[model samples]
Target: MITKVTHGWRPGGLVAYLMGPGTVEEHVRPRVIASWDGLDEGWQPDTGPGGALDFQLGRLIGALQVPATRAGLPVSGQAPPGRGYVWHCSARLSATDRTLSDEEWAGVARRLLDGAGIATTEDLGGPRWIAVRHADDHIHVAAVLVREDTGRRFWPHHDYRGLRCTARELESELGLTPTALADRTAARRPQRAELELAARQGVEPARTELARVVREAAVAATDPGGFVDLLRGRGYLVELRRLPSGDPIGYKIARRATTPIWFGGGKLAPDLSMPKLITRWGQRGDATERLDAGVLAETRQTLERAERILRGARQGIAAENPDGIAHAVGDVVAALGARYGGALGEAASCYDGAARAPYEPVPDVGSVGSELRTLAGYLLRPRRRHRDDLDALSTVALLVALAALVQQIAQWRAEQGKRHQATAARDAQRLIRCTAEERRPRRGPPRPRYAREVAVDHSRRENAVAAIT
Candidate 1:
């Protein structure tokens, strides 16, 4: 499950977008899962048989607006008059979870809204919202953020994080597959426009590519200087933040030599932060490095190539041609199978080695690997039948699954790199300290006190004889 929350100053446009037929298809009408009114009792709008859809929509919008007007709050300076705080959110279940009924889904939506502190009874005085089920496996909820009786506004604190936590809890309760939680420090992913550009240009998106490069460089380089040089060789412009005395405090990366836009290392990835890197490379000097420049570069290029292949396949799928879809699915299956299989094998090998050590148990990557292989097999022989039997929706699901698997593998590999780097750095530091101790000079044993006094008296007598002569 995933939840997206966004707020605006107007409800009419948002309500229309959710309830309008244009959201799904011209022929398919959206289903009103549930509706409520804060001002009136038994005010469920007529969305039943023989009821006018337009009238129901108007009633829905009116319910959303009445609270804002009754609150008597000033219009948001960011928007024009008659526009107040409108809280819009969507909760989407995985496409595979298609057995849930409209009522069940609505319950999930309500729980999420309440958890996120958006449409709570205490906050709004009453339920003043509507949940619309779209053709897709998702529900859209629109509510007025202003209280109807007290004229108070409700702003959710840390709304995104709250939504994520609620979604995770719901996933467990609903017996759904759990997904990786969002990293608070992770940069905003590439937008749809950037993805489309990458597809059109037949190149990997800059943000994704940059993140991959940064992660690899962070693991392979022995010291901060080496890390900077490694990134420079990879065609990324590196900017280092320094103190007045010329000590590096932080760093950022640009996509190329000429780009003015830069992303902080932490923004690119949590592990790529300057402080994290310093911790990984303790007592940093020229240490024994494991991964060389060639290996790192090759790995990055392979990832980029795979991304390009996936993008091309997605383009073909978008065309909606039967033959094209088959070809696309085959290409994706082939490319991702090899990549994910290799990653899984590597992870398994590392896990085996770590298991021999007395350290904590390594997580079982075998299960994830097995899942990836199963997904690959599904793509290879969908429906246990011929390719001609493949439906568009099934093909789309396969594509989404393939993408998810790829991302999972990438994350696994990144984590493995961090562990390897830490181990290598510790070994290197031990070696350095041992070598320094071996080379250190030693002092001769101290002479006895009587022997030292006799030598001193002899030297003094010789000096007196020379002075007399």
Candidate 2:
């Protein structure tokens, strides 16, 4: 199931829409399924012809707005844009899911409102709200934020997140099609304006083009200067937003065009942001460092170190970070992509979300993280190695270890409620595992996400561990 949240100040407008013909004539038998006042209280009024408003509709709208009205909130006229008295959420079942009965839909609505704290079992007069069913597979939940008993305005804390959790639980309990959790790890989608402009100009959207270039730059460069140089080398325009102290605070990239509209790093992906990306390049050094027989040993050691750090973090409380390994892990994966340039490259791209946590900046790059970054730097150079230098067996061991770390990353992300990120991590890990699976040896069996790692011969792993659980 999927849910979307929206808000407004006018209860009349929302109620009228819910009870009337939908935007696409999709509404079928529009009527109330549930309300803050029980059905016996007549919140659902008779609809006029074609589900249009009538005198009784006024009563229903009045009932919803009473608390706000009593609390001296203006219900009509140009009172102000953000009164936000109206809270609306639309919950829709997947097309393939079983259709829910009206009573079951009511229960779902009640559970969501209770879980979201919009209206709770203990707060009988918390807020006046209703669930309206106009279609078999969905319902619209509308609530006025003003509490009936106290006439005081109520705002559900973190209700958007709350709705997501509740919706997941409801999907499980009601046998609805499961949806991905609302982990903010996904890249920022291009807005309607950007899409429209792109369509008008007959070019790829600026956000899409910029994200591709920025991600490429992020993976290839070892320093801020190199990152900038790589973008410029790619023939894109790069502009740094800096502080008065001559330090770069942020950056924007754009395609070279008559009007080069720019996009910030954050607009590309959370981890792609300058502050976070810079932290991953700790003490920038040569990306073209030679790859030799010892390079295999170094890579294995780096991955093992990261695996151990994550294992410790998992054991620690939720408050502890996995020591910002995400930034460096992205580097490691991207380096593999740069070197291998096939499925590995696609894996690196998919792992982008797994390497980022929502809203959190990458903290200090620890010793292990630094090692991973340096290893990545060495791998980024294309002319660095021969088959004999990093043989198949040793390469398998490194891939296995990297897979284990990504699996642990997936688990950590899942624990942090970042399911989207976890999914991405798993996809990337799958691609990597698939690439190495047939030839992967069976000594040190790959541990599952969040499992205790057993020191074993890296060659002895099974289907490799997944990234971001």
Best by TM-score: 2
lDDT of 2: 0.78
Question: Per-residue alpha-carbon lDDT of model 2 for 291-396, expressed as tens digits?
Answer: 4556666788778877877877888843234736765788788788767777887888789777766656665556667677777766655544565444678777
Q: How many clashing residue pairs appear in each of the predictions shown?
A: 0, 11
Task: lDDT for model 1, please.
Answer: 0.53
- Which ranges of candidate 1 are over 4 A from the true structure? 23-27, 35-56, 67-85, 122-128, 149-154, 171-188, 243-246, 257-259, 283-469
**TM-score of every prediction relative to native:** 0.53, 0.68
Off by over 4 Å in 2: 9-13, 20-25, 50-85, 93-100, 121-127, 146-155, 168-183, 192-205, 232-237, 254-262, 283-288, 293-327, 336-345, 357-368, 378-421, 433-469
Which lDDT tens digits does candidate 1 get at residues 265-369?
Answer: 766644457875665444222322232332223223333444444344444432222212221222233323323343322222222111111121212212222
Model 1: per-residue Cα lDDT at residue 51? 43
Worst 10 residues of 2 by lDDT: 459-468
For residue 54, what is the lDDT in candidate 2?
A: 39
Q: RMSDs, each prediction?
A: 25.9, 13.0
lDDT of each: 0.53, 0.78
Q: Which ten residues in a row have the lowest lDDT in candidate 1?
A: 353-362
